[model samples]
Target: MRIIKWVVRLLVLLAVIFVGGAFLLPKETSVARTVTMNAAPEVIFPYIANLRANQSWSPWLDRDPDIQLAFNDVPEGVGAAMSWQSEHPQVGSGNMIIIEAQDPRRLVTALDFGEMGTATAYFNLVAAEGGTAVTWGFTSDNGNNPMFRWMGLMMDGWVGPDYEQGLNNLKKLVEGA
Candidate 1:
């Protein structure tokens, strides 16, 4: 009888710790990865501006070769959007729409993951000595959800490596083009 009572008490304590820890987590999070490519901003910008072009360089595309992709009519600049569905959880269903575009310089997108949430992602370029420095980043708000706040705390570790690989792929494609 005493052992049963202790077990219940321990479970309750763990639950409290988890709930309190989540509340202490940050309300927002962002992850960024940068790469310097041996190409001018003009050369690099076109590849990023078009959603179709991304298929050739995005790491996520390679993850689910059979993923279904639907591109909006605009397809290349502001207003261009793409929706994807994949069986793979890592490449799950979502859509992204280009919200801001500054030719040869920057591009920003509103990314939506249906029930998962929404985020803002951007690609910014700066001219460098022999090429362009490109930064790919995304920011998301956790609101007041303890589960999301916990996710925010681990967002960087979960997404950073993929960002790195995508940038590396972009570098190879542009340089080899």
Candidate 2:
């Protein structure tokens, strides 16, 4: 009976610690990956600005090759949108729409992952020494949700590799073109 009481107390203490720790976590999380491709921004911007063009380099497609993708009529620049559905959990259903486009410099998209919430994805192009530096990034507001706050801590590790692979695919596509 004494051991059972002690075990219950320990579990209660752990629950309190976890909840308190989650509140201390950041309210936002972001992940970004950059790659310098031996191509001008003008050359790379099209692939990013156009949802259809992105098909060649998007890593998620590789994860679920049979994933169904639907693109809006405006396939490039602002208002361009693409929604995808896949049975694969890693390539779950989501939609992304281009919200801002700065020609060959920057592009921003709003991404909706349904119950997983939404995030902002962006591409920034900068002229570098040998070519253009393309930075792909994602940012999510965890809000006041303790569960989301805890998950935010792992966002980078979860998303970074996919970004890296996507950038690498982009580099190969553009540089080889």
Best by TM-score: 2
**Per-residue C-alpha lDDT of model 2 across residues 24-136, encoded as one tens digit per residue:** 99999999999999999999999999999999999889888799999989969999999999999888999999999999999999999998989999999999989999999
Q: Give residue 49's lDDT in candidate 2 (0 to 100).
A: 99
Superposing every Cα of model 1 onto the true structure, what RMSD results?
Answer: 1.3
TM-score of each candidate structure, all chains considered together: 0.94, 0.96
Model 1: residue 100 alpha-carbon error in angstroms: 0.7
lDDT of 1 by residue, 29-105 (tens): 89999999999999899999999999889989888889999998996999999999999999999999999999989
User: lDDT per model, in order?
Assistant: 0.92, 0.95
Error of 1 at 118 (Å): 1.1
Error of 1 at 76 (Å): 1.3
